[model samples]
Target: MFSTREQKLLRYLMQTEKEMTGLELAGHLHITSRTIRSMIKNLTAILEEHGAEIIARHRKGYQLHIHDHSAFRSFLKIVAFERVNEQWIPSDPSDRIAFLIKRLLLSEDYIKLEMLADELYVSSSTVKNSLKEVRELLTKYELVVDSRPNYGLKVVGNELKMRFCIAEYVFNSAQKTTELVADPEMAAIRSIILKQTKRAGIQLSDIGLSNLVIHIAIACKRVLLHNYVSMLDEEIKNFEEQAEYLVSRQIVTDIEKSFNVTFPNSEVAYVTLHLLGTKMVSYRKASDALSPVNLVSEEILTLTANLIDQVENELQLGIHDDQELINGLGMHLKPAINRHYYGMNIRNPLLAEIKQKYPLAFDAGVVMSNALHDSLGVHINEDEIGYLALHIEAAMERKRLKPKTKRCVIVCATGVASSQLLYYKLKSAFESHLDIAGTMNLYELRNYPLESLDFIISTIPIYDDLSIPVVEVNTLLGNQDILHIEAYMVDHITLVLDYTDPELMYFQKDLQTREEVFDFFEAELTKLGRIPAGFKEAVIEREKVSPTCYGNLVAIPHPMRPLTKETFWSVLTLKKPIAWGDEMVQYICLLSVQKEYEDEMQKIYQFLVKVIETKALVDQLIKIERYADFEQVIKRMEEYGSR
Candidate 1:
């Protein structure tokens, strides 16, 4: 049987078509290059008989080649079956940290470091290092690892925080909740939650329902262990007055009868807090009597309006007038404030995807987060920011549905008949794609409304520079002229390559940390007089709002707001991957956009999103050392995007 690392290595190789160097594979697996070499040699021997071979290329790296598809499929099936039955062991530092946390949380008594190391099949020192990360993670939940000499270590925190931490670390696993708790018990808890919420007319999202079930199941487990959440007399009194408290009591009573266990009044209040925190409000038009915004308080409405205005000011996305966004965000904020009041951390499973796919909207979410923090004094986590981004992204999508066509005015030096002929030809060629506002002479273009136009399609060469792009075409309007006009139409996505400065590109740099990368950018850009001294400071502030690390070994860092006179990218690729926020990153693209081009920044963000999402593209780009080769990759990306 293949070892866990070998299986992971093979899985990674199989997922991608591109070659992966030993260093790259090692970086991903969190192991030494020497270990990767040894593993590949052994894995090669095993895979050969299974109709697969590991191809080692000269300087390129290794790739997986399957000679017999049927045999490889059979082998994968066997591996899948084995994985289902096999006991999982912690293979990486992240895995070990999670394992240690789960073990410590579940255990009532102190657990020895040596016992943990033995269970994880790792050295005591490894467990100790992992515990440091575990301790850091626990601090977020106000929990700590109480280390007692000779006794070992135990998790120490408030019962409420302990359950929250448990819900996050233990129950929030790749494996289903039923895998951790008994399936029957989880099913019963879920059934009770669904029935009670439905009966109370309390609409809950699928995630909210699952969270309630997990928390109640955890409460049951802890209560059986003689651990109960503590609450002040005043707090319980206030909770009892809420409608959620009555619903919670009914749910808890039914659970008690089914499980043959009793819950204290404080436990019912605990359930009520979750109900209030995770409650969903259906959005409706403000004109409707049943609108959620009608139920929302003035404070929340004002806050939501301010957030929308702030995002619109920063992004110029024109979403401030979106009624659906206004209503949805107002409704989301009501529960969000309650969650903050109760110290609850609602999980957003789509946070990573949201960051990658809807990056512009996510940045808008960041702007909203900063506004909320300033107004409400609540620091919204990435998960909550992701939820906010969803609303903004929906608004963005709605805006996209009625996309603004490329508007152009024809400039003709000839007579009206020739101009009309040219306009008719252009319209016949690109009727759906372009909107010809009107035709005018070059002299009349001086007085025309240039602000409303995307570009000017001129028959004759215009000598003067203008605010909008001017595409000079033949009076006859040939196929090549049509293609040139088309290029201008799609320039936002295709012109991304132009933003990458060859002088700004740094490849295979020996940077050790995020600070080192920042310092390098500061020094280089400063020497070139490309940025102000405050540029790095602004970027750091942006990172503080939310780390720009979008996984896939890529990070696109930028100032919180536009600080440059022109938009451009300063690219940096490290010799080795460095810790970037919660992920590892080697490709850092320092994006600087001009203040006036904030509207066009969305296109740039979309381009960066494509780079972040395409693992193969990032891997290929990071490996490149030459500017010419980098240009080729970017050109390919542009071509692929155009398709």
Candidate 2:
């Protein structure tokens, strides 16, 4: 049997397609390089027993080699089951931080630092460092870790915030487990809540129902801890008049009877708060026929319209008339406002992936949130912004389907069977966005016309220069190959660039913080009379909301709103990487768009994404000291981008 560390190592290796260095693995696992080496040695022996081995190369580090996939899978299952049965004692810093938080959150007594260190089998100093992360996590929930000289530490905060934190972290695990509906108490409460909501003619989506169950469990836990949520009497009186309040009362009455606990007015108010905010019904058709003002409050409707207006005005996403988007935002904003009023943090586990995959939609969401902030005096958090992005992305998709589809041709070196296989694979992967014009063998490519074809997906390497881009891939296409082809199809809108200036493109500037980089760009633009005053303030405000680092050592910093009279991109290449939020960046593109212009900014964004997706281009561009070198790299990038 493998240790927990070894199991985690194996799982990570199996999932990753690229070879990982010892240092990279160490950084991800939060352990020393020495520990990584020892663990791999131990992991190798255990893996060999299951016909798997860890492959090591001089430059590429380690890769997993599995001879019998079924054997390795069986080994993994055994390890996983064993892990579940055993009490998990975390060894990694991040895991220890989570473990420490659960301990402090659930414990009624102060946990001594020495005791924690001893239990985790770490030094007191390591435990202390982990506590710092715990405090940071708590700070987001408006909770705190209080310490005494001898008694050690415990969590302290308002009862509401404490319960919210508990619901977020402690119940987050249970929400994943069958424990949520599988537990007898929770299942009964879920049934009662569903039955009562249905009886009252209130609509609760599957996710909303799950959310309500989690809140109910949290309420039960808090009540058991004698930490009751308190609400103002006047507010409770106002809620008593609403239909949701009545429904909540019935549900709470049933819950109290089932759980054998006394029901308080405050507890009833808590459930009512959820009911009032939860999505009542699908407003897609209603919003289309009648204005959103009829379904939701006039103020929120106006706010939603203004947000959509600003985003469409800037991005020209062609989604302003999307009724579904309008309905989604209008419906979501009502609850979002309620969440803001209560200072609740909505957890988004997909935030990082959302930013990576849907960068354009994410920016639109940020703009929408800023519009909400300016108009309604409502603060929107990143998680809520992510939720908004989903709606915006859906609207974008609807808009996309209206446009002409991109067409591509597939090339296979082998027999007709292989070509047919590759052709079908491409169709399955991109049936909606792409049109598979045809497939051809290597020799038949000579007569094939490339004028109308968007790009080429070739199973074999093509040595000949071609006008259209050709993505080399295996007969059984992989993810990276798909991404390569998709990149071309996506950027097919237009590859034109009118913003790059030799004078504005600075190369290899030694800068550190985000502020320093912004200050330098703002000063240069201001000196050239290219930007107005307070442009930096707008950029800073946007950065404060969410850092613009989009992975791949790239950061595209732009103002919260259009500040320049003309759309242009100002480029900066750092001599070395600097921390831009959580991601390290050496490539910076400062974007300043005009207030009104149907420009090809999306194409320019595609160009930037091209630069981001290719590390060779970024590395070469970063090392450039002259304009010629920078231009040369861009030329090479364009050449590679073209074919």
Candidate 3:
């Protein structure tokens, strides 16, 4: 499956390729113009790598003008292996004798050849050939294949070692179909991932994407193996070095080739570091109770990932927040019973916090983890090491990030009373909690760089885009809302340390997801089959107050909208910019606010300004053919809120 990074780039290219200017490309890719230029150069080189050409013009940027696209397509067709591994159910009997050998290697206690053949979806003969191939494949490991007429086939060797061999064979065979589809989305994601890999000067597909996944998997597995290590000193040293090699190389390029996906070295090393962290966390105080070596057979590593997939059928859980599902997952692994006994619960709070605060990250991690779980028995959550790795990963988000310092930009219409009240109140709330960055008055909102402010609490209205998460409140700062704000402050205490710290919100995500405008409609109207709660009331309230029609057919629709620290925006199009009675509105924008505050109103105004700035981009949405692309436009508009 395409990774989030690859898929996002593909969608971006699909959206903006109509104009495809270097500037446009840079904007869509969220990269520097220089990076896009280098990407074009590297993209051209890779096309040439395949004996194709990427055509470019002065202003037009670049296009993959296939010299011979069909030639590359031909390279993807699978060549039938003569000695296909036993785990493979071959189509024909070219190596039928190898089937028993393959069967012998794979069968645990009994060689249930009939059962194996059925599971493989092959006839007994085809299964037989695969078995023969398995035997030949394992022969080099000093393994011999033998069968019992009563029990089925069995491989007599270092059983664990032979199992690893079988796993390697099965994994490679299964990934034979891992080529790009002609679908534009898949093509784009593939191109982005492959291109990034090549640009970093990493060999992607040549080494194979599966191999890369394996390499990383091995690194993760090594950590898992570390806790279970029972070998003599030499073996222990070898294990340590092998794990270190993955980190020191600063690249999982070899593994990337196997998957044709680019994984950053820093991220890879962090995985190692985090696994180490989790191992420390799980065994808190070393225990005298020791479990024997529960060997991670390559087959089990690869296979068990599938069997447990029955969880969907068994538990009837659809994936929403994967991290939450994963919090209790250590119970699943066969070898790591200690994890079942001790690991899952202790780290759950961190996972809960990660899921709450970093919603985007939480969602992505869950989806990818579950997707991998579904496809391969790669139970990432089972590896508590990966959990610690994510924390370290988030911790490593910024290089040389300033420590828990505060940058508070406070605002009130009249700076003396309400604004000062907010300032002092905020100071009381956060002074001991955060490194205060700075504060602001209503008039200064237009001048401060949004990123410079850590928090914005304003009374009355304000208009500059502060680039910080703005919290809108009332001027009086009453007891109820103060209680609410207190709850909010208490919930996000960790964010004071790291803005992106996943633990910032703890378990309060459910409460806040409701603040969203779309959700208000869905929960109140759609779900209850009842009259809407806040939205309809807002519309009536606005209509009663002389209609918020701003002449140009533009109007703001909102309920008393309640006081919220959140902002929401939605759009509508007129066949023509119509007049609201006497006034013409070429465009209309609306906001639901926490209170009638200058700072909150200003944020809505700034959002409009951005929409106007990107007028050209907004217009292109009219031409978009697909629902998916249209939805992407909405998502991109939301990202504007992030920036």
Candidate 4:
């Protein structure tokens, strides 16, 4: 695995398609030429293993070349595809405006546009103004539209880009967002602190305190994941444990499940217990070699020292561990003082996975790491450290659910207007709990049709011979029409997610391979009822904003809304390969959030990152066919989780 710095350099060379000198690469990656050479040598080995090689042209930097694009493209699927559409594809000032009025263009052909006008009750002309550059955009992609006196306008080519444009154009209303979205986490932390205060019989708000905790947590993850480039025996381990320890004490739960990992496997038990009992530094040496000394984030360590000092003076909360904090940041930040460009090398595997999963985050991490070094006297590899925090946070939100349905299809209007609204409505109705495949519109529902859909509901009535349950609504979205349908789905998904997969939650004693893992998770979801808003269709649409895949043979497919569960959950592992965008992912840990556990959602979120880290464990779980054995594994994990 290449370090983030190496990966960034590799991406730049691939994108630039030109020779970059060592000086330029060092400048871009923000590392010394000597470090650049080490990174290049390592990268060459990784690429060579995959039947590709990096060419070093004298003083010039290096270039990765492969004879085939397919493998490279496949690799891209695991990393590059995560940040595919974070940027807004814009218009050129010189381009011509071309508008197509849906009213004029089609009477029988349906392309719904109500969401765009939803807030404004948009008219055809208003849409035209917004789409002034539509024609120019289509032309740039080498598509042509033949226009005449009789036939006003028509799209003549480039089907993919046009369809993509149309799909994304109306998708803005779906409220799709990049997750670990900060807003919710902040709120959750605040609520927890308030509860803690209430328990302690104190009246303090601790408003900024939650942020401080989160920042410290992020910093600790960063140090463990990002090499400080200083001393060999790093002190980051203690910092990370401190962060987790603080969270555990304040929140009354492990960071992975947030609710407390009750039956943690041996490894989890060890880690959690170590954090509670010992300094994070010692835990690092004992748990994983790279883990210790890596926990100290330069900024967080320094800021933590300062904050503790202030708190000690004002609140009289006695904190004399200032030396530890100083030691943590003092060394980590100094070596990071001179970043060449993209920042230091990508030495951390977790950070590499994160960067591979989210390009924008990787880029932003680079910029932020360098800026923080310059401005705050804090130095660290931003992607490594920054995203390590992301992983920890994500792991906390993880929810392990079982296949709740036999099969089901969520019908919205061609994924627009009523369909779009109805989709999220049903998911919400189910409390965001359901084992769903993909959602579809009433029109092309059969085009990407599944052999089995246990149920279907829509505004329009349709009859089919397939024994598939159908609930017809008057319109796709709103009051009685949509609510009744959603209420039913909630029940179905609840049942499937809880009962069906419960048998498979145990850990298997045997090892799993790539193939056996494939057969599981290709099942269904029926309805239970009263789920959180925005569950299935809404979740699928959220995915439209960005592919849900987090790269590295894993993707956590979920809706934006939270769901309600019945306390117990069933985990369904796929036994067959399912295409997760550009790559194939063997596992997807579905979650069903039971209503009472809202405060502890962070635990499940954090567990997901752990799953990503331990791919081998996931592979082992996927290979088990017997639901009974799966239960054993879950039992093992649950037993060990409490530590």
Candidate 5:
């Protein structure tokens, strides 16, 4: 079997298509270049028989060449199975953190750093550095790593918090639940939970089921260790009155019989909390979807309505009236609020993918969270925000699937006959795409309901400023006129380049940190009088909610709310990548949207999302030194988006 470092090197090579130099590998592995070379030599010898080999280029790097696909597949399966069967060891800093967390959580006495270092086969300094990240992780659970003069380190926190941390860091570290516990034991626990939930007519998602099973398994283990969850007398009384308490009791009774262990009332109440937190609504009729259920209170309904209103008013996503979204969000918030009240953290495995793919919806989710905080005084974490975004994204998809007919009113200075002729011509050309609200003369145009119209197709030029767009066309409605109106009807980019300014594009900058980037932006924008006084602070506050780094070497930093009077993007490309939150970014687009242009934010984000999702474009843009090249790339992005 390959060593942990060798296996990690192989996995890294398999992940990327580009060749990696020895220096780069050494940096990633936190080892010397000489050591990387030695490891590469040893790996090459082993992989030659396994249908893969490492080819070292003169100056470029080393690339993995896989020649025998069948042999490679069998070799990978054997390696994976062997790794799963054998005792796991820490290979990297992340793995070491998990290992240390599990060790600290399980050990009754304080463990020395030297002892951990020996277990990890690393130096004490390495263990100390890994502990910094461990401390950060533990802090999220209200856990602290206490150090004593003679004793080394121990995790100290609320019993409930410690159990929650242990459930995540220890039991969840393995890919399969059976790996953490005996296969039959896990199966029995899972079967009991499923049977009880089904009998109670309670619904649980796949992730919810897994979490419940893991927490129950952890409870059983902790009970064996003489540790039990404690609750206030009033809290237990309140829990007992709930329906889930009875269900929890039934589950505990069955498990006690199967495992030959008894659960205290506090443990039963703890299980009831999990049940309440993971509860899902199974059915809702479409006619009265928004009608409040037993769990959904009037306060939750009001908050849900406000959130939908805020999203619609701010983004104009056309999903505020979506009944399914209203129902889904209301149902989701009930259990979500329960989780928050109990200080339970629900893990969202799709948070990263949601942020990357559904950025606009995720931003809408952020808006909803802010509104929720204002109304309920509860801070919704990123995981809950991600789940909220899924519902919003689904609504967005539903809206997209429906035909988006553009509404317009035809205006002409000529008599009714000419206006009527022009209306029919437009209808004939775009019957399915355009919804002609009405035809009227120029004098009657003032009385028209402009709010309901998307644009005005006028035969004569109407110089009066209007809220919606105006497309001037001949009475005959020429081909060019048809194309002009088509731009409004189709989902085409209406000059996305208008949001980008040449003066704001900075290339190959020497900024080394996020603060430096903000400083440079502030100095330049302030000189041009483009930003408000507290623009940088607002952007930093938004970052605290969630980092703007969406991967592909790009980060789009913006204020929490609109603070600029004009909508525009300030682009910056660095000479080298800088740390932005957890990801490294070389391309930065500082966005400042005008409050009046909030409706256009979705379109603006779509353009930025394209830049984030396309790696080749980011790589090309970061390497360019001229604004002309950058402009061309943006233009290409616009062209691609229009299609």
Candidate 6:
């Protein structure tokens, strides 16, 4: 029911809890101030019907206010399904870029820019700008856009490169992305694929199944157009013996009968390639659990172990013994290795969020990536690393919660009855996480052996210096007192980063490309003697491994390894956004660390993750022209994010 701009505006408003200014919205949507105002008026008109209205205030911008929550929710549901039922066209630059790429990729003939502009409801000049971005995106897939003056523009490249580009942009976009597909058609394909995969003893999650369905649908469409993908005789011979190939054949055979289309061996091979990327070992019964080792290959298992060991060597996460992690990583890596062998591309939608929230885990994933590169010769992209980080995160969670209780001694200055009451209160509060070692008086605290206990909970003022932390509580403890004791019992992983120096912060700097921004930072830092001679090269090398641009208009570029004598972060906010490895970035944080440092950096990483996670915070940081304002905004965000 809404235009593309309206949809994007609604989505942005929904994502932010605080009020957003028109200027902030304009920056994020890449539209002008006047265009933002016009779009907001249009959006408000549509939203009023659903009991929702955009509330505008002086100096505070606009926010969505709902008159009836139930009605607003119903409106959202309708919009979601409408996307599938109605013909949807992109209204924003990002979506339009994707649309243009898919259109150019699938079109048999050249498409005229005037026709594109007409269809998209944009000006000819806007279309031209979108095409430039399209050309940049195509370069990643090794594809090119060939433009002629009289005729128009068409995507031109190798047949294999074209297919890969289609697989990445067109098909992958359909897999749980914003692109809409007919529900009935999507559901039918998923059901058919599920039946075939189940019959073959291959397991896939719902999202994975949907992804496969899209791949098959693309393959079918391309085959009908006589745009078949063919592998060499050696590759085809090797694929014929694969179990996944047989499963793919069965799936294609049923699809052919239902869709009234015939698929050749090459098409079947193409389907098998997708299968190899997605198939997982089915869960076995407890009786057959001991034979689970036979599910995945020994090579993959060995590689998984090596990867875990590498992470352990780097971060010491202590997840190498987690069998579930080992199994999950092994299963994931099997298909990943297959993809590398054939140079296939896979996308992870959660990659950005994973990098933002789990920076330490992502760092460990980088270590695992290097190990995989050395052993399997497969270069790991950030998307694949995100999946690996998920497994590592799960293992860390398990390790943190493994039935281990803390031992503590409670010291009481009052009578035995009060001490007993405090003891019962502590037990009720901590539950399973704490074990009361014994109760002791303040006089007995001097002779008390505190080495065996994790921490001491005291009822009276005992100022004796001790190795273990001491929590002072009242004779009759309240909720706050219990919480205070629990704080010592629970190891807080929340990192409130306090590393942004006032001198290192640069505001509203005019920078162009990724290279230009890095160059500016290098020149500034080098002039101040803050970094080594090879610091810039170290940062560039890290980019070669993977771009540090983690989306949300933020990029935290750091060297592959520590290259500085001191650990510090140099931050710069650009006045205008620039292209940074397939994404637009404005806020840049150049991270540097001393070599062979032993400090725990979970807190610092958490802080950086917070910056990456919040769009409003980034908006606030961008508008700030002074270091004091920047620091104030960060402090405000820290307070808000904690809430």
Highest lDDT against the true fold, candidate: 1
Per-residue CA lDDT of candidate 4, range 377-415, in tens?
554543335432342223222312333343456665543
Residue 119 alpha-carbon offset, candidate 2, angstroms: 2.2
Q: On a 0 to 100 scale, what is the lDDT of residue 316 in model 1?
A: 87
* lDDT per residue (tens digit) for residues 45-95 in model 5: 889998999999989999999999899999999888867764556655666
Off by over 4 Å in 6: 1-7, 10-20, 26-97, 110-136, 139-161, 172-188, 282-291, 403-484, 491-533, 543-555, 563-599, 607-643
Cα lDDT listed for each candidate: 0.85, 0.77, 0.41, 0.43, 0.83, 0.77
Total backbone collisions, model 3: 51
After TM-score superposition, what is the CA distance of residue 641 in candidate 2 from its true location, in Å? 9.0
Q: What is the lDDT of residue 234 in candidate 3?
A: 56
TM-scores of the candidates are 0.85, 0.71, 0.27, 0.26, 0.83, 0.72
Candidate 3, residue 213: lDDT: 37
List the candidates ranked by TM-score, beginning with the highest: 1, 5, 6, 2, 3, 4
Model 2 spans > 4 angstroms off: 1-60, 63-86, 148-152, 173-184, 280-294, 312-318, 403-494, 502-534, 571-578, 584-587, 606-643
Compare candidates 1 and 3 on TM-score and give the better one.
1
Where model 4 places Cα greater than 4 Å from the true spot, the runs are 1-352, 355-524, 527-534, 565-570, 594-597, 635-643
For model 1, give the 10-residue run with minimal summed lDDT.
282-291
lDDT per residue as tens, model 1, 1-643: 6666788899999999999988789767755577799989988998898999999998999999999999999988988875675356756556668778888998999988899988889899988888889999999889999999998999999999999999998888654434356978899899988888777667787887888888889999999889999999899999999878988999999999998899999999999999888877632332457655455667777789899998877778988999888888887887888888888988999998898788888988998988888888988888999999999999988987874679999999888999999999998988777899899888889998799999999989998879889999998989899889988876556567767678999999998899999999999999988898799999999998788988788888999887888888899998878878877788899999777755666777878888888878988988899999988887788878777
Candidate 3 per-residue lDDT, tens place, 107-213, comes to 44666778767755667876765676666766756576666786776667653244344434433332332211223433443454344444333322222333333
lDDT, candidate 4, at 64: 66
lDDT of 6 at 604: 65
Greater-TM-score candidate between 3 and 5: 5
Error of 6 at 513 (Å): 6.9
Give the CA lDDT, 0 to 100, for residue 303 in model 3.
37
**Model 5 stretches with alpha carbons more than 4 Å out:** 1-9, 12-61, 65-82, 86-88, 108-114, 144-156, 174-179, 282-295, 407-422, 437-488, 641-643
